[model samples]
Target: MTESAFINITELTREFKNKTALEQITLSIQEGELFGLVGPDGAGKTTLLRILAGLLQITAGQVVAAGYDLNKEPEEIKPHIGYMAQEFSLYEKLSVVENLMFFADLYNVDVKEQEDRIQKLLSFAGLTEFKNRRAAHLSGGMQKKLALATTLLHEPPLLLLDEPTTGVDPISRREFWNILTDLHLNGTTIIVSTPYMDEADRCSRVGLMYQGELVICDSPVNIRNLLDGDLVKITTSDWQEAHTVLAPLAGVKEIQTYGEALHILVDSGKTRLPQLTRALKEHNLAVDEARTASPRMEEAFISLIRKMDQVN
Candidate 1:
């Protein structure tokens, strides 16, 4: 491992049969850094996390994590990291506190200190009141919190979470992030893969994966600036027709639709706003709303993936 890198990967790759899952994934995450992995479906996010957690084999390359070579000492690295899978199992028969005690015992927590630790974790995960509630009886959000609390039983220095917030409600997701923020503040390095762009924006840095490759990795602001053009958001009753007209017009380079609003990338928002409006009017389309808008993470992510598709 590098002197300061908590998790160091060099030219890592994973293969299943003939399909390449991860290709030359080289990354070094420093201590206390909150790294977010973002990409479309089947982008190798889970593959990379599984390799780091010692749950999957790397077909090629090197990984040094927690001061151990993953290839040679997979078991040695396990105690240094807390890995939570998307479908991490919780005994549906056990209550929240029972589940915590089970993992604490498994981790070999000191008999005398286990009670104190479990209590604190229950409070931390906001499950103190639900201590007696069975895992299966808990809501999707609460169950996720319980799973997270279980992973922290050993108080590992690093956390590898794979879509911990999927299927969770918005409020619960926010609360989950709050717990993560607390962990990050206390100097625990976290590498989380999420599809939500807003979640990616919360990380100190983000790595975008695509087609079994780490396509881009940088700060959220830097990634958004990757698209060197302005964005214009427009809403029209005739969005289908408007799309057909605006897609081929001058200055428009890319377009995406979100519900009834259309987001268009152009050479310059100031120059294209009037040009686009005029073109829409010429086609007799009613522009419900149109304005120059700030570029967002989703736009940047899609723009990067689109460029990658073109290259391939």
Candidate 2:
């Protein structure tokens, strides 16, 4: 293996009792890169992270993560990876420091190193003042941070996090990402799965998963440029009705909704802008506003998934 390729997956597939979670997934994550996995729910994001963390059994294919062959030596791989699940899996009854000590024990961290490590991690996660407080009494965001601190107790080179900031307040979510950014700057290879498009934009690279396969993986800038057409955004109370009216228009290629607004992909933005306005007027649907807008990651991702669905 080369020095940069910290995790290499080739034709990896995982199957359960009656379902296949991942199929033919081949990816290479370089050392110290922040990789984001973004997709709709049930897209096998969890399965891929579990496989890398030595938590799930792979039915076929090869995976070399953290300099250990996962198929042959899953236990050896554990020491080199720190995995944080989506839920708050730390002990609720224990104080913040206790949870860290427990995981430090599980990972067999050096006794002499435990106190210093725990003290730094508490301050690092902003849980220092709450160190004596029970984990169950911490806020949602604090609990998530505590879980992250426990994972870091092992001082693993690779971090595999699954939706770490989901369901948290926006401010707390921002705080968690700041911690991740610090880790990345310190040369820690982090692979995180998140449903938030904004979070995906912050990564060094991103992978989009669909239906058990990795559909696309690239830098966020390149992914935004992958949109084949320009976007014409329109706001209306009844976007569903507007979508039905304009979906079959000559210039409209794809229509996706952002809450009440619709992002319509078109062959030519200026030519289709007027056509869209006229069509809406003809249908007696009052559009709040219509203009050519730049495509974002959310639009590109939805477009790719739509294309994949069409191909299948």
TM-score of each: 0.97, 0.96
Colliding pairs, model 1:
none
lDDT of 2 by residue, 1-312 (tens): 354698899999999889899999999999999999999999999999999989988899999987898999988888888999988898889999898998999999999999999999999999999999999999999999999999899888999999999999999999999999999999999999999999999999999999999999999999999998799999875888899999999978899888899989999998999988888888888889899998999999999998998999
Off by over 4 Å in 2: 1-4
Question: What digit string (tens of lDDT, one per residue) describes model 1 on residues 125-172?
Answer: 999999999999999999999999989989999999999999999999
Candidate 2 local Cα displacement, residue 107, angstroms:
1.9
lDDT score for residue 246 of model 2: 93
| All-Cα superposition RMSD per candidate | 1.2, 1.5
